[model samples]
Target: MNNKEIVAQAVYEVVEEQLTLAEVERLLENPKSVDHGDVAFPAFSLAKVFRKAPQQIAAELAEKINPDAFEKIEVVGPYLNFFMKKEVISSMVLKEIAKEDQSFGDSNIGNEGNVTIDMSSPNIAKPISMGHLRSTVIGNSISLILSKIGYNPIKINHLGDWGTQFGKLIVAYKKWGSEEKVKAEPINELLRLYVEFHERAEEEPELNDEARAWFKKLEDNDEEALSLWKWFRSESLKEFNKIYGMLEIDFDSFNGEAFYNDKMDEVVTLLEEKHLLQTNEGAEIVDLEKYGLNPALIKKSDGATLYITRDLAAALYRKREYNFVKSLYVVGNEQSGHFKQLKAVIKELGFDWSDEMVHVPFGLITKDGKKLSTRKGKIVLLEEVLNEAKDSALAQIEAKNPDLPNKEEIANQVGVGAVVFHDLKNDRLNNFDFSLEEVVRFEGETGPYVQYTHARAMTVLGKADFTVDPEAVYALNDADSWEIIKLLQSYPEVVIQAAEQYEPSVIAKHSIKLAQAFNKYYAHTKILVDDEQRDARLALVHAVTVILKEDLRLLGVHAPNRM
Candidate 1:
């Protein structure tokens, strides 16, 4: 156990005489103010159980129980205040940091377990927008956090390379597209064709029927339709890869909805044999009204399968292939009803493991108080946003740190990190207004600020000539030093919490808290004092550097050493 847990266990020994260990652990709280003591236990709850006044209970307990882990224990107005040995806590924390280094927050709780996460399912023939950013980074960070805790996380891009969209793209391409322009700029040219088709279809309603017919032909494996569909998929991936490269993201599987085409037949047969499939208005559906959900449509009257059918096939295929302990679908909140129907249908198919499937939904991204829509071409391209951030970071670097080496590399890290960190710092379920200017700012709770703090810690460590001695005990009793130590000590718990809650914002917020504490300590305390003091302070700085770097890594943000 760490120092905090050790102290809590000691308190548990005394408190268990009247209450359980779980209750004692739950009651322990870190005091917000230094004068209040290191840890406080409110005796008010125990007064009701013991049939005595809270102050009397606290006073009696403080006088009777004395723990060696605490330097002093006293009663103050119905509360038991416990003071820690600052020197002991500091020495232990420094030694633990020195021992563990980058693996400080890792655990083995998820050993031998597996998780399959489906995210970044951007549609084909269109550029990725700021709207897809949440699923990409949030899913990526959750995977990283799971791996840190010893789970084998399977990352799937789950590309949206299926359905009637491709048919529309083909129709648009035949009417307005040129081979030369498409080859030169596939996504933009295709997007232009798509937008044009929608505009013209408003007048020429026959285009809608034509598009649906083309999709049916494609599903029937028509050679001409397949060729066009394959070309669109290939070109779209090229654009997607460029964006993925800029974000430093990779996926284990690109098995999109198209991959389940042949597999859907077996799933439908199983549903039919199990009596789960019902015909309603010539469409195949699973009746879920008994379970309080809308009927799940499996196949259209024209024999074309739906998204939920493909998902059902994909889920069963995943269970057979990976036997995953949990499968997470990182989709938007708009699809909550779709997932509800999906899980219900899976359960109806007699797969009790359907409970393991999770729908990790996030809110929408807006621009000028309007939802982003590619149909209207009113969306911001992710590439442009990334480039603008890079340009802003480059300008800042040129103005502030002109002599900094590898300026371009540092600019890339800071710039991309700014956009990504800004998205991650907020709760995923909360709608955020996307603004390039607000996110790229180097001050406040921005990514550049944390990166700069990390660089500052690195600078202090780099100037020190001697290495930290793990066994060397030091008295770091100042309020700032103690605060830094306390925050550093909580890094492991923060990492665990991020993984458990599937929220990368926990680590993002913790990084800002640690950075703020370190900056406050840096302004007042000098790292380079006498030889021994310098070494001890270097140890602290090194620990901060290690943690800040790892925390940012888990959030999928780069921490440059010389930003």
Candidate 2:
């Protein structure tokens, strides 16, 4: 068992003799400091039952608690805190760090259960805007955390490869799109045609009718419509692959809305079998008024399937295929109502596991307190953001270290990491004011700062010609050393909390804190010395190197040893 689990078990044993395990768990809270002990229990929670003062109850428990594995017990106000032996904790941290390295903070808490994550469902033939950034990065990080905790995470890119948008594109393509232009710049050319079609539709209302007719033909499986749609899908995927390559994100499945075209009939059949479908104004919908949701439109009056219909089919198909313990939809908070209705309809259709579905909602990204909009062409392109950050980081590298090798490669790592780290440092539920100037700044709690700290530790390790001896018993009594050790010891807890809350920001914040602590310690202490203290200090430095590198890897940031 891990230290926290072990400590919890000890606390459980003490409370089990007097109270229920559930009650004990309620009493146990995270301690403010390691010195206040590994875990703490508040007597105030039990004061009414015991009919005694909180301090008296805490003192009584401290006196009754037997010292077996715990080092000591202390009573502070109404709190009873237990401290583990320092040597035991230090040794545990060191041994685990050495044994796992990159996998140090991981645990089998997920127990091999399956979790299906749907994210990055950017529309085909459209450039991925900064609007999709939150869903992509946040979903990827949640998947990484789940996998680290032993969950079989399935990453799905529900690409927007279907809908009337394709019809509009097809109509515009036949009218004005050039094959050569599309071949050379698939996304840009298609997007241009799409914009022009909408702009022209303002003057020519018949264009909308024509587009709808083309979509109907596509739905009827017309040969020309099918062929052109296939070409658009293939070309759009090629462009998406380039962006995915740059971000280093991969999906286990790309079964998008198009994949559910034939399966929607089955979903409708199931809904009918369960008597949950109702016709409203000639359009099929599920009456969700009783569930406190607006009626979810399943089919339009013209018999065209909506996004909700495709999603219903997709959800059922995933369950049949993966039998996931949880299915997470990592979409924006605006879609919360959509998911609420979706889950309600699934449950009404008698799918018991529908309860496992979750909407991992996040707020929109804005600039100057205004929401980004693609229709108005008032949004930042994701590629532009990445490129700007890279260029800015490259300039910083040239100014800071003129002799740095592979400047371009290091720039890519630092720049991309900065964008990601900045997005993740805040609460996922809160909207962020995104600014290039703020995200790329290398000073204070940024990705570049953390990377520099890792690089510095590498430099220290290279300067010291010392080897780590696992058998050596290093004394860690110095204040600086203890501070570093305490941070290292808390790594697993940080991972657990991040996983439980489905928040990558927690891990991102913890990594920056560790890097900052290490930098402070390095500036104050000397690692390479001419005495036995050198070996112990070198070992500590090595430990820091191991952790910072691992933490950066978890954040998907590259730590160049020579940066």
Candidate 3:
């Protein structure tokens, strides 16, 4: 059992069945100041039972409570503070890590239920930009975090492969006349025509009308439009896959907006049967005034299906396919209202499963303090940024460890991991500016700092010739070791907390804290001396390596054994 459970059980014994063990555990809190103790319990709740002031009750309770698990119990005002035996906790935590290794903090809380994550979706004819990084890394990390806790997370890249955008691109391509250029560089050529189409549309409104006409033709499966759309989608996926390979991410589903084309009719039919469809300004919508949301537009006045219509169809499809316990959409904060409308419309259809859908909204990644926009052709390409970061990492590795083996592999790990880590380190809803230099640096709460710390610990283990010894008594009571042991023990709880809140930043922040603590310990501790505690100290270092690796793994980062 963890220290908190041990303390709770001890208090449960002395309460004479007045409070259950679970109740006592719930009541326990960490002291604001470490000087108070490790765990604190306020006696105010028990004052009525003892008919005494909280201070007296705490004093009496302290006297009656067993002290085996604690170094001491002190009564301060109305609180009973517990300082656990550092040696005992250190031993338990170390042995547990040695035994569990990569499986230390894993749990089966999900009972193997499925969770659908819609994330990393980029449009068909555009390059994946820095703006898409937030959803990609955040969703990827959440998938890893959920899997660590036993949830089967199905990642879906809901590619924006359909709609008027494709029509606009086709219009631009035909008018600007580009078949050979597109063959040479698909995304760039397509994006160029796309941006030019928007620029021209501002002055010539008729271009938009032509774009709409072409989209209608594509929807009706006109041979030329279909061929062009398919060509564009195929080329885009090839480029997108190259980037996904670099990031070490994969998706279980690539069901984009087009996949639900035929399925949308079912959604509209269902809404009509339910009598939830309303006419608003020649458009078809679902009135959601009761849910305090705007009317959800299902179909445009032109008889074209809207985004909400396709989304409703996709929701129904996912339910029938995955039977997911929870469905998450890792979209941007700007689209929060869209999801609210989606869920409200689903509820209007009388599907109770609508309650299980969650919109995991996140803020944008900006450049020069401005949001990146694809429409204006103003954005940073994610692939270019990753390549630059990788090159930067390689240069640093050459300076620090020139002879390091597998230089390319390690540099890729460090570089790609740095970008992914930077995106995840921030709170999901907090917008932040991106800088390549700051992200890949070897110090200052960056991914490389944590990676370097892990590498440093591994170096210590190698020098000591350390190996897992389940038979050895690995224990340490030194202030530094105790702090790490406490953090290690709380890892299981940390994973649960991250899963509960759908937040990856929890794991990211915990990793930074642990790395900082380990660095401090390494500076002052004589861990390699010929002494009785040598093995235990090395064991602590080994434990740190295991956890730091696992922690990085959960955040979708890698921990290299060497810098």
Candidate 4:
């Protein structure tokens, strides 16, 4: 139990069960300052039950409560502030962390239920750009956070490998692209062809007809079209894997839009049989007028399946395969209406689990206040950004600790970590401008700062040759240590909060706070001085390292032992 629970239980027992434990817990609040106390209870609610003034009620309750768990309980301004026994609380917290180590925040709240996360679905034959970063890292971090609490997270990269765009690429390749050029640089070459097709199609509308014809041929498994599509997919995956490798992210499934080509017919057939499909301007759609959404276009006038059709198939397939407790689609916020229509159509089909599908929407990452666009050729390649970040980290590390071992490896961690941490530190739905220099810096509320603090702790432990016995007296309960202790004690609750909100920012903010507090503690306290509390101080340092690493791990960032 945390300090709040302890105070609530004490107050409940003293009140003769006048307020149930849950009610007491709800009434408990943290004091504004350390001088007030660790936990405070405003006596306003108890006045109705006791028929007394709040001030008098607080005084009487203070005297009635047991003093064993707390050092003292002070009554002030109709509030009872409970100050916990510092030595006992600190020792218990440190000892618990020492015992738990890396598994400190482990829980079985999910009961091994499966969660399917559809994320990082970069279009095939296009370089993975900064626009794709949010879904990739955010989804990866959420999966880690959920898994820490015992949920089995299945990450699916719903690749955009099927579309009319492929048809355009085929036309461009046959017209202008050379096999040698494509083999040398597949993504860049394909991206150029794609842009050129759009530019030319503006003047020559007949090109669109030709592209559509090619797409139909490809859909029907024409030998030449299928061969080119396969080759494009193979080369695109190779490019995407390099970016994923840089971020150290791996997906459980790579089944994409193309995979649902055959399955979408079943969806269309089901909608037709259920009378959900309606004709509008020669196109088939599911009317969602009652749900306040646009009609879900199932098939275009040309008889091609749309994104919703493929999505419906994918959703049904996931439910049948994973039996997921929660099916999450980590896509951009612009498509929220699409997801709403999807759930509406699924609900129309009489499946009660439509409510289980969740659309995890996030905001855009802009460069110079403009959204990056691949067709315009104004895109920040994810690989180049990561490489630049790594170089920045290497330069900083070289200046700070020239002799540090494995500088290259450590730079990789800090560089990639900086980019990921920057993206996650913001609220998920807030669009923010990006700056590479600001992200990879070692100072401020950045990934490297937290990582450096963690490295500092490890260095201290190494110098002291600290080994946790799990039985030593951790009795350093000074005021400076109190803040760090509170943070260390609250990690488990933070993990649960992150999981519940489907928010990675919760964990990221907590990591920043813990790092800041420990830095201040280090500045004020003489940790290595020879005294009775030396080992206790070292133990505190050890606890900080363990929890810091775990925090970073949950955020999908690594905490290096040296930096």
> Which residue runs of candidate 2 sit more than 4 Å off their true CA positions?
1-16, 20-26, 29-40, 45-52, 60-74, 81-85
Give the distance in Å from residue 128's predicted Cα in candidate 2 to where it truly belongs: 0.6
Between the candidate structures 1 and 2, which one is better when assessed by TM-score?
1
Residue 145 in candidate 1 has what lDDT?
93
lDDT of candidate 3 over 393-510, digit per residue (tens): 9999999999999999999999999999898889899999999999999999999999999999999999989897976788788888877988899999999999988899999898
Q: List the residue pairs that clash in candidate 1.
A: none
As for lDDT, the candidate ahead, 1 or 2, is: 1
TM-score, per-candidate, Cα-based: 0.96, 0.93, 0.98, 0.98
lDDT of 2 at 240: 88
Identify the superior model by TM-score, candidate 1 or candidate 3: 3
Could you tell me the lDDT of residue 545 within candidate 4?
95
Q: Give one digit per residue, the lDDT tens place, for model 1 in 515-551.
A: 9999999999987887556666778888889899998
Per-residue accuracy of model 4 over 254-277 as CA lDDT, tens digit each: 999999988988998899899988
lDDT of 4 at 397: 98
lDDT of 3 at 466: 83
Clashing pairs in 3: none
| Runs of candidate 3 exceeding 4 Å displacement | 202-204
For model 3, where is the 10-residue window of minimal lDDT? 370-379
Worst 10 residues of 1 by lDDT: 1-10
**Candidate 1 Cα outliers beyond 4 Å, as residue runs:** 2-4
